[model samples]
Each structure stands twice: as C-alpha cells, then as structure tokens.
Target chain A: MNEIKIFSPATVANVACGFDVLGFCLDSVGDHMVIRKVEKKGIHISHIEGFDLPYETELNVAGVSALAMYNTLDLDFGFEIEIYKKIKPGSGIGSSAASAVGSVFGMNELLGRPFNKTQLTAFAIQGEALASKCEHADNLAPALFGGFTLVKSISPLKILDLPSPDGLYATIIHPQIEIKTSESRAILPTEVPLNKAIEQWANLGSLVHALHTNDFELIGDALNDVIIEPYRSQLIPEFKLVKEAALQAGALGVGISGSGPSIFSLSQGLDTANTVKEAIASVYKNTEIVFEIHVSKINTQGVKILK
Target chain B: MNEIKIFSPATVANVACGFDVLGFCLDSVGDHMVIRKVEKKGIHISHIEGFDLPYETELNVAGVSALAMYNTLDLDFGFEIEIYKKIKPGSGIGSSAASAVGSVFGMNELLGRPFNKTQLTAFAIQGEALASKCEHADNLAPALFGGFTLVKSISPLKILDLPSPDGLYATIIHPQIEIKTSESRAILPTEVPLNKAIEQWANLGSLVHALHTNDFELIGDALNDVIIEPYRSQLIPEFKLVKEAALQAGALGVGISGSGPSIFSLSQGLDTANTVKEAIASVYKNTEIVFEIHVSKINTQGVKILK
Candidate 1:
C-alpha cells in the first residue's frame, strides 16, 4: 500500500500509582493522520486540521516520526503527512503520542510493515522527544500497542502490554485549561521520601496485580498517588472536590491524567462511569472553564490503519 | 483438637525490585510451633529449640504474636507454645516472620480457626513489630498467604496473593554472615532521587506484569533493584561476584534476599537452579564464611497445621 491513513488512540500516562511507567489507551479521543508516498525523497507535512501544529518536517511530531521511520529503514521514497487532530494538545491525554504513534505506524505500513511495534515505538519516541525534551514511552507505548502498557526500561526499550480487565471504563474530564507538561512535571519533588517511595511501589505493584487478576476493588484501593498527585493536584482548579465527587459517585479511583487539567477515573461499568462524569461536571458547572468529558472503554486496538 | 502443631515457611522479602512491599514464600527452611490449650488465662512459652529465644510472653516474637491473638479474641483459655526454629535468624530470610506467623496461625487453629489469613497477618505484624519496632507485612504477608504477595498498604492493610507460575524455582544461598535488619535499613537513603525512584517503580511494575503473564524473560529483565541493592549489597560479601556468576550460569535474576547475607536467584528450572547454586558456591569456596544453599519451588501452602 503506497498510501495509508492511521488512527492512534489517546493514552493516560502515570495511571495514578505508576508514575512514569504505566499507561493505558482510551477509545474515544485520538488523532488521525494520512501518509502518501511522494516521488521526492523528503518528508513533508501537507496539511493540519483542528490544531495549528508545526507543518515543518523537523518541527511536526507526525512529520518527524515519519521521517525517523524513513531514515531508519533507509527508504529512497518520501512521504507526505496530513494530520487531523481530535485530541487536544496539552490535554494531558497523550495528544502528542497520538500524532507520534500515528505517523510511525502509518509510515511502517507504507514501508511495507518493515518495523515491529517496539521498533515503531522507538521512532515514535524520537518524535515525542521533540516535545518533552526527554524520551518516555509511557504514553506512546500504549498508543502504539494498545491496552495497558508498562515502560520497564527506556535504554533497552522494554515495553509490556498488560491485560486489560473486562468491564473496565475510563472516565476522562478535560477541563479545557492547558497545563504545560513541563510546568506540571516541574512541580514534582526531585527527591521523594523513602517511606513514601515504598508506599508508591507497593501501590503500583498492587495495581498491576489487580489488572492481572481482574480485581476491581483491589485496583480501586491501589489507585493512590501519594508522591505526585499531592503536589500536582493543587494546580488544577477544584481537583480535590472533583475527585471526592468521583469517589462518592462510585469511581474505583481517580487522579490527574498524564499531567493535569485532565482528570481520569476508572470504573467497572457504564452507569458508574456516567455517574462519575456527572459528578465531575457538577463541580465545574458554576465555573467558567469549558470542559470536555469522554467516557470510553480501554482502546484495545491502539494504532490502526484506516485505509 | 486441644493441641496443634504448625509450620510456617521462610520468605524472601523485598523480592529484588519490590523493596519493603513484595515477598514470596519458600518450600524449605521455616519455623515450627506447637500450641496447646491450658486452664490459665495467659499465653506461655513452654519450650524453645535451635535458638536462645526469650521465654517471656511479651518479649519473644512467638509469645508476642500469641498474646496479640489472645488479646484480639479475648479467649477464656490460655495457651502454651513450643518453638522449633529451622530458619536461622539474621539470615535475611523471614526467620522472624516464620515465628510470628507460625505462632498466630497455630493459635488461630487452636481457637477453632477464628481469624482468616489477613486477620492472622495482622496479629503476626504486631508480633513482628515487637522485634523491628515498625509494622511491615512484606515478610508476614507471604508467610501467611504463600506464593508471591504484595502488601499494598499497612494502615488499612491490603495484601494481594499473586499467582505462581509453574516450574518456577528459587535458588537461595545463605552465607554465614549476619547483617542486622535495623542497621541495613538505617543505611538506606532517607530520600531517593526521583529519577531512580521512577526507574524502580518501572521495574517493579514490569515485574508484576511479568508474574501475571508468566513472561520469564521480562521478569529477568525487570528484576533490577536500583534503589536498595546499590546500597545494601555492600553489606554482603562477594555479592557482586555471586550475582554475576549466577546470571552467567542462566539465573533469571539475582539479588540480596531481604536485608543481606542471604542472596537469592530465580531460575526457570531445577537444572538452572542447581547450576546457579554451584555458581554461587564457587564464588564463596575460598572464603572463610560458611554458606548454606537451598533450591525449592514456591511454597503454595504458607502456614499449615501439621497435626
């Protein structure tokens, strides 16, 4: 296939207890990208919709990712990319990851599927690094491979796609306020207390176990972020009240998605998910900030070719 | 039904990547306790073997654990306990946990199985606290519940028993050196760098996922302990050499068991386990320190009534 269109799902990184290592894909919000083989041997961004992202090959995430794949494969052919962004940038829901993953994934298919998921993720990570200044696969891994993904090591690039429990729903509320990922990251403590670190690992281990065993209650109990959320949550307006409301409305656990402004909660059913959404909305009803709420089951199909 | 004899298996706390939170039970090396009903309204230690343990009800781990159970139940009858210790104290395995768990577990059975595993773990933690000055269930949880266990929280105690993959072998080498648990713990940094902590959680999250999915290679890659091993491994003699040798000889991963002096390696089969045992022994062959090696599968039945 000389031309291909791919859709990559939004991802929730950090996943409450698992900071910098855990992430899962969402079904509803994502980015769409189309890549077509060009006669010229250079990458180009032809068009961008919904957001004013960089169109230069080196500046655009999708363009850079496709370029990385092109260079990695030593392809003589060039590709032009067209991006339609549905997931808002700075939404803390892996908007950048969608573009990065979609580009490499689409390019891989255009290049006759020359790269595996891990190799594709490597190129995607290079693209993502342009935005974050550091390479992290927590968001991109899930967006590329689907389900819950754990970035075990970045140097060796170990990514594990974890089992997503049945009946799990993600309730995401994008507060429409942009929180710079860098600023949100800057608020985190450079050094965490040893006791708190222990608690954090315990919670992370328990959360993984819950996913493996499909224990919803254990997942709820383990969805605690003592280290990051305690500091970062202060930046988001009404974070505590919304979280409290979500819990009262039967959310298993709730926390800031990726970096904040967007809060995600895990629930077992649609009813509880809708309830959590309404509860979060009620907190922002009086506020002037426009919010977008999306309730979705986990995106088991991560990045896929649309054409 | 007036008297019962129980055996609680030794446990490997910390489990490499999961510091202060993860542990697994072993088939061999444990403490045995025999408890009998008496007319007196107090707990007593009638006999001790293999070590010079305190005979007082409040000072001894077995005594304190029995007392905790007795107080929790407000039983009308007293009990006398006889201890036979097989796991050497200060060996870095769960020697103290064996006593604490065996005592409470035996008492519970004597009292017609009044407390469940979690409740029994609670009593056991209280008993262990008498020795450690703090309550931690990393050792006690696995000792009480068997297999791999994660203590998610201590306040509202949440423990998860992970599934043990078939054919998994544990090769433990206990060098005849003593490292005080308190001193070992005291040497750890009061705070950890956020980057290292992030790597640690990633390894831990990956390890749990590996266990759930039975991914041996992933488990091998993720069995890294950057936070504790770098600091505590210094307390154990020939730690680096032994670990390297074990890894070269086909061990999945190797690290100091619990606090130190005992180093454990995970292998997929008995052949590799025996090879790892020889590799560890070859490292310490010229040294003056005596060492004991035991290779066994995971103990599924943690504490059992031996009748």
Candidate 2:
C-alpha cells in the first residue's frame, strides 16, 4: 500500500473538430513511473531515465503536479518518484500530460486514493499549464480519465466522458522538430469568422453524435479543423502533404495532434491505421525532418498500475 | 393514400448553444393542413383560414414548398393545399417552418413517399427562405424528422437526429412585436472572439453528449449561447429579465427561439415548464407588449397525420 508502479498514457487533444475541449487517450504509448512513501517530508525525484527533463521540483511537470496534490493533503510521510520516460516532450502527443498524470495518479494510489478523478485532473493541469503556458484540460482529462473526454467547461471544471467506438485506431507521426506550444498558440488569430465558428461547432457536435452512434463515415466527415488547423499547421513542415497522404491512404481523418510537430490520423482499424502511418512516414522520409510513427488503439483505461 | 390531413408541429431553433444547427420539435403547438391530389398540373391553394396569407403559389410558403416538390416530381396529377393556420408568422417559433414542412410532408405522403426527410428538408427550406431569407435547417430538420435534430452541414445536408430525454418540456412566450428575421440576423457581428467561439463549441459538444446520455443537469449547464444571444437579445424587450425569471422558476435554460420577440425556456418536466411560463408571462406583463405563452412536451413526432 506504501508503494505503487504505474503507466501513464499519452493523449491526442483537439481531435480535429474540438480545438481546446476534446481529447482521447492512446494505448501502448506512455511513460512508466514508480513512487514509494519515503521518510522525507516532501516530494522527491529519486531517479530519471531516458528523457533529459528538469529535476527541480518547481521546474518539472511531474514534481510540480505531485507537489500540487501533496500541498493539499497535509500528510506526514513524503513520496519519492522514479520516472522511466518513453514519450518525448514537445511531440504534441501529451508527453507532459503523462508526467503530470503519472505523479498524481500514482501518488493518489499510494495514498489510498484520497482525491477523485476531477481533483486529480485539477492538480495535473497545474503542471500541464507549465508546458503550454495556458490552462487546458484537454490532454489532462483524457490522460487521467481515459477514452474520449470533452472538457465541457473550465470555470466549474466539468469533464464529460465520451465513448470511443470499437475498431477506432490512431496513427501518430511525431516529427523530430521543436514547436513550442506557446509560440504555436500565439500564431492563432484572436478572432475567427462567425461562419467558420458555426462550421467548427457543427462538426464538433456531429463528431460527438458519430462517436455515440459508431458511424465511421460521419466521423470522417466531422473530423475537420477549419479554425485552428489552418494557422497551427503552418508551424509543422509538410503538414498539408502528410494529412493528404494519410487521407488518401484511407485514414478516416487527419490533423495535428496538439500544438503539432506530431500529426494524428484516426482510422477504423489497425490495418488502415498502419496504412496511414506508412503513408505519413513516406512523406516525412522525403523531407529533411526525422519522424517516428506509432499506431495504437484508443486507450480506454487512462493510467494503469504496472505489475 | 391520395389525400392527407396532417398536423405539423412548431420547433424551437437555436436551442441555446447550437445557434444555426440545433432545434427540437414542440408538441400541440402547430398548424393543420389538408393536401389532396388534383387534376391541375401545378400546386393550388384551395383555402386559407385563421390567418391572412397570400394564396399565390410562389408567394405562399405552403404553396411554394409544395410546388418545389411538384416541380421535381413532374407527376401527372398536381396537389391542392388547404391551410388551417394556427401558428403566426414572425413569432420566432418556426411558424413558417410548420407551413413549409406541412405541405412537403403531405405531398410526399400523397405520392407514396417519393422524397426522404433530407429532400423534404431541402424542398421545405426553399419555402422557409421566403420568411428568413436564409436556408437554415435547424427548425426544418426537427419539424420534418422529429425530436432533437442537428443540421450538421448545409451544403451536403447532414442532419443528425438526437434523443430527447424523458420529461423534457418547452415553454414558449411570444410577444406581439415586429422584428424581422433579416434585421435580427444583420445586427450580429460578422466575427466573434476565438475564445468565445471555443466556449460555444465546448458547450455545444457537451449538449450533444447530454442528449445522448440523458443527462439533464449537463443539459442545463450546456444550454449556453455566448455567440448569438448577446446581439439578438437587444431586439427583444426585457429578454434578460424574462430569462432570469425563467431560470429562477427552475427552467433549465432560456434563449430567443429563432430570432427575436419570442423566447423559449426548456424545463425538466411539465410542472417546471408551466412555472417557467408563468414566470416569463409575469415579466412581459409589466411591459407594454402583449404576449401569449404555450407550454408543451418535447414533440418526438414532428408531423402527425390527422385521424
């Protein structure tokens, strides 16, 4: 009960139609972490492997998120965290969210689950905000709660869990390039055409309906990003080409995963997802940018305990 | 089968957050029309009752919509429409939609159902444009397809039918004031803040989810219209006061039904809907404008055949 080992998952926010409010979790792609009650009075980073992230408690997402949760509970004993990173930071597939959620999820487990999922999300967002320079629960909600999630509102923090239809798979292509979330967000226009806004919301509403009905054609039709993609795609090289290739290769839909540098294509099955991945990989191979492709089923379980 | 007498229900479009794409049909508040196949080669308006309207095929919405269907059919026999009007035009409660839908629905039945709901929506929209000067399917979709409907796209004409939770009721207040739909639409800004757009889409996405899951509290929270209501409310007198009163009376949410002068409140049950109606009626009582209130259950059947 004093120690816990967990696997925190990566997530894809902005599922094309929902810009800052919707996200889905990814299976088989995540970071492993181990946390145990220590004699120290505060959160401590015992070991870090793979990724070269900050070790400072205030600087790192894991340390900061864990501290956010720890500060609330005036417990006597402290917890020590050891992270084995697999997902790279800034890949736009919720690498930071995995760290943010891992610490809180594991700590909560070690503490006999004091806080609920909503509270865990609240704590996780504090660290996620450090990465994006803005508060967004899209990735944090999915990474914490699993499957598809709609960050319905931020003020009262209402997160709606949505169903992920069977056979749905995601193909993520992470280009080895730096695209700061803040800079990418800054490029977006403060105002959007009212017509475009209507179009975007219509697509988002339909996408939610399609998910519930399990209509793949409707899902493909609703996977349009007319508002943010036009602007954010400019930061990722060959985004248009990659998206076109993915669509041509039978992906249900394609868009930048988050702030980008990573592109995600959603398909009906693993075969179509793999086809989309190979098509996207070929597009990147011709370019000077290095990229990694991962195909995974939509993760229904958010964070899992590592046995 | 050669003759049809039908009751076409009124609808509340703009169901708060959905703006141009969402609507729900209303029970018992509509118009009745009798359509029959005649030897004439074109549409004929045989009689008009309860309201003053043009009998000219092109000038009348019922005649115009029926003609639109007839033109495409190229049938040997034409149809005659007799309107027993109950809903007043410019009431902001889909009065025009009732007429537009009635004729097309009746004619389709007389022809043994040649056109589907989408085609009926298409033909009905042509007549509806005579009143609104725009082709919006929010009201038309619900009036034709019944229950809650989302007009997800305009060009391709994608209409998604959504479930109406049990006990859902609508309270509509129509103030005797003149507000043109075109003018009401003109007052809105061409652009909206991106943040506001994001908030709107989030609410809309949540609303869609709420409909699917039958979550009433979430429906209340998600029935927020930040993008369109602000500008359009100025056209209606005491809109804010009426909305506040309805909410205070336990109504789930309130918004301008379609454009202006008429406001609709959705409540959990018939009792709450009656309470909301009384509350809204009280607000308009102090003002100089005359008003009428109608409370009804959410109509799952759009257009019903009269026995």
Candidate 3:
C-alpha cells in the first residue's frame, strides 16, 4: 500500500456581494493531509494533531466526502486518512474547507488523480456540505484552484479565475471570537430592497472591472457592500470603527471578511498595509479577544501537494 | 461670425439592463449641424436636409437646447443653425439626442468650446429631458463621449466612459416602426420583483465585466434583459424570431435597442456580424416595416465637429 501526501491552501468565502457565489485561495493560510492505501474493506479515519475531529466517518467531514465519492462511483478501494489542521476552526476563515479540500486532493492523488479539478471541487464541496449542512462551493473553489475566483454558476459549478490584479495588497485581521456559519447564514434576509440590490450589482460589476483592469481607484470605489454588510456588520463589534480606521489609515478600502468577527482591508502600497494593521490593532485595544494580523498577497495558486 | 460645422453622432441608449444609465455612439449613422454666427440676439434653427424638424425656438428641440444653454450661462451669443438629420425621428437610434447634442456641441464651438465634455453632456441631457419628458443620460453620454459609457449616478449626473471592448461588432437593425418613448416609459412597472432585480444586477455586473475584459462569450451570456426585455419585447414585430435567428447566426447576443422597435445584435467577428445581419434581415422578409442594417465598430470618439 503506497502512501500519498497533499497540501491544500486556505480560502475566504462570501466575498462581499458574492455571498455564496465568490471565493479565493490564500497561499499563506491552509492545511495538509496524508492518505495511505489499505487492504481493509472500508475507509479508516484518524483525527490527529489538534483538529478536534472525530474518528466516526459520518461525523468526519473529510471522511464522509471521501466515502461519498466512493459510493457515487462505486469504487472498491479502501483507505486510511490523516489531516494536519493548521488554521483554527471557527476563525471565519475557511478552516473546514482546508480539511475537506485537503482530503479530496489527497485521496485523488492516492487514487492516481483520475478526476479533474472540477470533479475534485464537487467532491470537496460535498465534504463542506457535511460540515455546514448546506451545499456551498465558495470556499472549495479557491481551495481547489487558487487565486481570486468567481463561481459563475453552481448547477455545474462553473468557476472562473479572474486576472491577478497588480498593485493590490490584502490585510486580514482575525479576532478570537467564534461565529458559526449557520448563524452567519441565518442572519441574512431572504429579500433585499430593489434599489439597494441594483447598487450592489453595480458595485460588484465595478469590482470585477477593477480586478481585470488593475484599477485601484475603482476597486476602492467598489468595496461598498450595501446588501449584507450593513445588516451583518452589527454582529461584529467595532465594525464601524475598524472600517473607518482602516480607511483613515490609507487603505484603499475595508470591509467585513467572509462572516463577522474577522475583517480585511485592501491597500495599494506597503505603507498603507502597515497603517491598516495598526488601525485594526488599535480597535481591539480595549477587548481581550486576542487578534492576529496577516499581511499577505493574493494567492494565485490554491492547493498544492507538499511532499 | 465664423461658421462652426459640428456633427453629433447617433447613439444607442439603455444598453441592456443599464436602462437609463448606459449608452454608446455609432459612426456612420448620425446627424450633421452647421452653426454660423449671426448678428442676432437669439438662436435660429432650420432643418436643412432629411427629416422635418421644428423651426420655432420653443418648439425646436435643438433651438430650445441652445437657448437653455445660453440662458443658463447668461451669454448673449447668437447663431444660425442648420441640421442635417440622417437618423430618423422615433427610430429609437437617439434621433432627438443627435439634435440636442448637436445644439450643445454646436453652441459650445460657437462659444469657443468654453464648456468641457462634462458641461456639454449636462446641457445635452437637459435637452433630452424635454424630448423624453424624463431626465435620462444614456443617449447624451454616448453623444458626448462617443464610445461605451456608464452613467454611475443621475442626481448630479455622474458619467463614466467605459473601455471600448475589442473584437466586438454591432449589427443594428432599425425596424421602420414608430414606438413612442412616452409609451415605452409608461409600460415599465414602477415596482420590480426583488429576485428579478438581483438577477438584473447580476447580469449587469457580468455585462460590465465582459465589456472590460473584451470577452465576447461572456458578453453574449450577459446581454440578457429578463425584467425589461420580456415585457418590452412584445412591442417589436417578429421579436422572438429575430432574436433566435441572431443567436443562431453566431451573434454573441441580441436585444432591443433603446426602447425598441429597433433591435441590435452583437457579434464577435466579421463573419458573425454578417451572419447576424442576415439572420435579422431574413426575419423581415415579409414584413412591411423597412429595416436598416448597420455593421458598426464601437465609436470611441463621440461628437466630432467635421468642417
């Protein structure tokens, strides 16, 4: 039985107006996995190295996803899997997605990579579905194909990798507060105002244009999220102050990243990036939430097997 | 006084879901105006060629516009204007916009180009207000800037000239039928469905992206008008067949051009352009409405004063 090892990058979901439709990978934030072929008739799962993951297949997001693929394809291969959880769970980053994607990628490699990227993405999304109890692809997309991506459609899951815009930097602030995906999803209203929806689309359209053209000014102009940001922002403490401070500190723009508790600011230069970090750190001064700041570049390559 | 010969190109307005906020110019189809300085106190306008236009200052669309500019700026420059109207009235090809923009540009040149493009655009929109009875910047924008444009806001009327996407061609079909702007405006519902609005925005956003990227496939996919098209398409004869034929003929897409009777097809290349034109022209084989077919490149330069 040969052993296979793979690494899948971290992802950010619910990118502004895209909600469940858009996401991207982060080369700096991700996880690793290992899969070993076995002669035992079924799959064996072990939760190792600080994952708090259960050994049961039904409860195991990664294991269940691997099993789903096997059942759907009626494959007879038995396997054992282990995951190295790096990104903390409940951090508003795609912590679960890293596990699910790592598992899919690792299993595919163990099985000789028969399935393509799209197929792998579908399997990874199934794993995400087990964890969140909702079929979501926003996180799985970037986890599969790195870089800024738009899920044009979900029926067949048509994903597109946008051009890597230059002169743009990202600063993410992760505050130590738990925000469940279910809770975040529940808070969104099923209906939005017509005028506001128009504005949201306009901004989103402008954002896509800005990324393609590498127009920082347009990107700044389009960062506004009128539909979800205004309503969900209340969940995060100091949301207003953080955004104001980041903008004041020379960020081209700032907004709530994915769900609440964690926020990100976009800067055009290094000086602005530092200012954004300082601004966010200052906002968390009075609270003991324990915050961490990441000054990273947009990851164009998502998940890669590292030894 | 010097005779200033200025030409205002014909324009395509209400670009897809942009409704009243987007437009672009056409090169071959437009109106020509000759403005000669006269020793007079008020502007005089005469329809010299083609269609009949009003001669009285208050009744004439061009004269009223020129008078408005003069009265607003408190300038006492007088001129004699002759309009060569190539774009017919009520053809939905921005016929009156040519007159209004012609007046504004002609007057600006007569006044030594004092007002910039933006200022002239404002005056041109004001003229359209009298014609449409509702303030819209779609037609006037393209008339001023000559290429693809986005009207970001209408409160103070913010206009943006979008990139003229490459490898894209336009096949405009003006069905010789009169559908009044007043009637078209009246049919639109004051309230829109929330979900429909979101879809509209999504399409609008994707359309903008397609334009910026010059992705003709995406442009074709994004040229839908679910909310407005379905309802307004009822007014055009052989609308369904025309659209189907255009799409079948390899047009990236097809849609009503600015509150039609007039329909326009967008193609990716010259072959597709000819195919789309033939497809559209074939539908009018037995219809009484005379159709004028125009194969056009996106006009990057709007109104030019050709001496």
lDDT of 1 by residue, A121-207 (tens): 999998898877889888999998899988888888888888899889999998988777678878888999988888888888888
Task: After superposing candidate 1 on the true structure, give the runs of residues whose Cα lies further than 4 Å from its correct spot.
Answer: A74-76, B74-76
Arranged by lDDT with the best first, the candidates are 2, 1, 3
Report the C-alpha lDDT of model 2 over A1-307, residue by residue, as the tens digit: 8889999999999888899999999997999999999988898988999989888888889998999999998888899999999999888999999999999999998888889999999998899888777788999999999999999987788899999899999999999999876688689999999999999999999999999999999999999999999999999999999999999999999998988889999999999998888898999899899889999999998998988
Q: Tell me which of candidates 2 and 3 scores higher on lDDT.
A: 2
Chain A TM-score, structure 3: 0.92
Q: Kindly provide the TM-score of model 1 when superposed on the true structure, using C-alpha atoms.
A: 0.96
Candidate 2's error at A264, in angstroms? 0.5
The alpha-carbon lDDT assigned to residue B136 of candidate 1 equals 88
DockQ of predicted model 1: 0.87
The DockQ of each candidate is: 0.87, 0.95, 0.36
Per-candidate iRMSD: 0.8, 0.4, 2.9
Model 3: residues with Cα > 4 Å off, grouped in runs: A1-7, A17-19, A35-44, A64-80, A106-116, A175-183, A287-292, B17-20, B37-49, B56-79, B106-116, B155-158, B165-167, B176-183, B186-198, B282-293
Candidate 1 achieves a global lDDT of 0.88
Q: Which pairs of residues collide in model 2?
A: none
- Badly placed stretches (over 4 Å) of model 2 are none
True contacts kept of each: 0.96, 0.95, 0.25
